[model samples]
Target: MRITNNMMTTASVRNINKNMERLSKAQEQVSTQSKIQQPSDDPVVASRAIRYRSYVARVEQYQKNVDNVTSWQEVTDSALSDLSDVMQQLKELVVQGSSDTLSDSDLAAIKEDVTQLQQTAIDTLNTSYGGRYVFGGYATDEEPYSMDADNNVLFKGQLISDFNDNGDEQAIKANIGYGTSVTVNVEGQDVTGMGSGNLFDTFAKVLDGLDSGDVSELSDTLDAIESNTDTILAAQADLGARMNYVSMVGKRLDNDYTTYKELMSNNEDVDMAEASAESATASTVYEASLSVGVKVMSKSLLDYLA
Candidate 1:
């Protein structure tokens, strides 16, 4: 086989160009800190990277949802605690008011205190966080309670509670005994189970009893009030349990976040140590190719004849 000088030179230049290209690619991989710089580098890795990016994005969105729900849950928990405190104080005042030794002035003072407690409870029911009502469920933009002309309380919100998980309408149970959509907004008309009197109606009667200086009429009503407090405590206990469950879920979410991040790193993030080793190996191969090309090109047809 006869080899020409032009062909030999062209082949040597091509080999050097190929080596330079491989070296440039290695440098780019190091600079970018990515093994799969382009789809041609490793199509499977590139596809995996795309899928990983989507998974990370979805995990981030889930974290955001968890943040919003957990924050609102905190507000609801605080409101429930405040309501319990107010109920406790009101119970004490009712006890004092129940005493036969109490005078008209004493009864009036207790009524005033009870009114304040009722107002506080109303305020708690209407509690808002970031302009959204905590206990108002999906009707977060609206107030949950309102006062009538007779100074009696009326619940304006629906009994439907909506607690979603991860933006899906997964009705996470907030109460054990109560259904997920339990109507918590007990209207004056619907109160039952503690004898015929409702909370709002019974409380109104208590006010009248105070005005007429009739303390004895409140005995049965006080019993009903105790029962009402028990109901409130039951609901609160349920809320507390829900809060705890959410907290546990939040902890698990954090763990999941960590696990996903690590998995993503393994999937997409470059291993610097391995990349450096590859770059070094490429450098050696490229340098060896250049040396071989120089040697081959330096030997011409005229030199062979000599």
Candidate 2:
């Protein structure tokens, strides 16, 4: 078939348009730093980016939970440490008051000191973090430890020693990872143990022994005080273990966050160097096609004027 000027011009114009489209696409990729402008450009890359972004979002939420739980544990640990210190003072008072060489007034003074220290311990057990009591189990809104009219220590309105006798104490758990959690609250019963009416009751006996000037009874109550200290230490140890585990989970989550973010970037981001080269190549082809299109249109105004 014979080639006509009109047909050549049409074909040249069509080819130039296609080249211009390619140039625009390459330039857009370079400028936007993305492999595709829309999902329709590469469905697989778009889908993978979505999934990876979702994974990153979930990891972020897990990280937030970890941070919150870590803070809770830290506050709880600090409170327990304070209580231990108070107990140490109580022990010193008991040791001093147990001696028979002291006068009645001296014994009375020691008894007063012990009473103040016991109240301090109770206040420590009622410690709150973020306006929620750390030792109240699920009853975080209320103070866990209190003294009744009879000097009996009550945990959430129940006798401290009898609080968990029926095994009804609930733990406060926090999710640090997928399907993984750690207990954050140290229960009041765990702090005082199940001996007699609890630590405060033992303190009451110590006070009574002091009041009546009975050195033997005051000396015997030292064992109960020691037991209370042991129980508090055990609770602290358990809390420490949970804190360590949460730290590990947090580290893993940080790794996961970085991994997911990199994966998403790889799926959607364009290589700037490659895209720039492709854009240059496409621009060269488009310009060449445009020049050829102009030449193909042989019948111009110049021909008419001639």
Candidate 3:
């Protein structure tokens, strides 16, 4: 094995280039504040980061679903509350008209009041949320209830008298979690006599009773009025349950968001303290290698002869 100047110089240059490369990588890690600048630097960490980021993205999407569901529920709750209040007012007016102590004019005024309340109920059932009807069920773009020129109540374009054919309809829902969804609406038919007493029909009875001076007829409406109120209460209860479920899912999503983010950080994010230390060590080694290479190259065979 002959010791040649070419071999010594070649080995020293290679060592110096290797140290420079190490320094460049360490400095880049520090500057970028990332564990790896490219996936090729660390495939395992890159794969894990991808999975964690995807988890974060999914959590965000489900969170948006939860938010939209919450908005829908809030709108539904408001409409139902107003509807309940209308029922209460109708009951009070019915009780007032139940007494025969009133004059003809008083009965007439009561009839007017009943008519206005009936219209109000009709309007309430047609309520919309975010440009979509709250009670519209599957047909959110259209009103649940409407009134024709004859003051005949209509539900989904069918006469109220005939709308009961649909019976009970399922509420619309939004998925807020994996395998979990929240119902955000109460069917409008439930208030208009589908599986419940017809509120408009009850209003008609009240008006008729006042028109005929029939105190007994108005008294008979207490049962119908009570039934309508119970229906509203039940709808409110169901909405509340859905809201609770959404809240629980939202909390879980929040937790998942935090967890996925932490995992991503652990997998991909750089540690400033450690990265800085590594950069400094690599820099020092590179400088030392350059010094040694200069010394080794300075004393080549030609330089010794000079």
Candidate 4:
């Protein structure tokens, strides 16, 4: 090999460029706080980072669903609690109205109170959360119960049996974890007995019985009111169970999110201490390479020949 000045200059320049590239890479890692800015930097790490990020995203969505489920269940539980209180008040009114010595004016006042309590029960059954009826089943847009011109309680929403034919009473479910779901709604019929002559009808009957001083009908309504109170308690229990399940799932999701985030950081995040050391070393090497290249390239062919 002649070992010409031209060849020496070319080789030195190439070496300097290689050193600059290494320095640039180190600087990028330190500046961005990332090991692999692009997939080409480290394909395996990049792929794993992608997967970990996707897992974290999914966990986040599950957390949101769990939150929504919790909110719905809380609303349902509150409504049931209110209904229980209303039923208790109605029971007291029924007992007073059943007395034999009550006058026509006294019976009228009792009827008025019963009517108000019935409306309260309807309002409780038609409770809404986030602008959607909690007991409307799938018909979240409409009220679950309403009173007719004849003071009869009607089921405005779909019943469980009606779900087969475009019914809105289907249970509301949420995905709280991988391949796991929980129902967050209590159907109106289940809570209010809307399907089998309803709690509201019982209230109306009590009101009419009180108005006419019909002690027999009022006594029967008292029994029916007790049954309705039991139904509300049952629905509250179901909501409580669902809420517990949601809470458990939420805790697991939080832990999973933490794990996924740690994995993602390991796959793509740069170690600041290591990156800083490497960047400093690369900078020194690049500077040395540039000095060497300048010295080599400044020498002419004549000087080499001499």
Identify the leading candidate in terms of lDDT. Answer: 2
Candidate 2 — worst ten consecutive residues by lDDT sum? 160-169
Residues 1-306, model 2: lDDT tens digits = 997767888899899889999999999998999998889999999889889988998999999999999999999899889988887888788788878799988997998888888889889889899999988888999998898998877888987666654767589887778899888788877887765747787888888998998888888888888888888889999999999999999999999999988998888988888988999999999999988888777677677689
Candidate 1 local lDDT, residue 9: 78
lDDT by residue for model 4 over 109-141, one digit each (tens)?
A: 988888898888888888899999998778899
TM per candidate: 0.78, 0.88, 0.89, 0.90
In every candidate, how many clashes are there?
0, 0, 0, 1
- lDDT of candidate model 1 versus the reference: 0.65
Q: Write down the worst ten-residue block by lDDT for model 3.
A: 188-197
lDDT by candidate, in order shown: 0.65, 0.86, 0.85, 0.85
lDDT of 1 by residue, 134-198 (tens): 55445667885667676856554221112112342212222212122222222211111123354
Candidate 1, 297: how far from true, in Å? Answer: 6.1
In candidate 4, how many Å is residue 9 off?
Answer: 1.9
lDDT of 3 by residue, 177-200 (tens): 787776777787665555324777
Q: What lDDT does candidate 2 reach at residue 6?
A: 77
Sorting all predicted structures by lDDT, with the top scorer first, yields 2, 3, 4, 1
**Candidate 1 regions off by >4 Å?**
157-198, 287-306
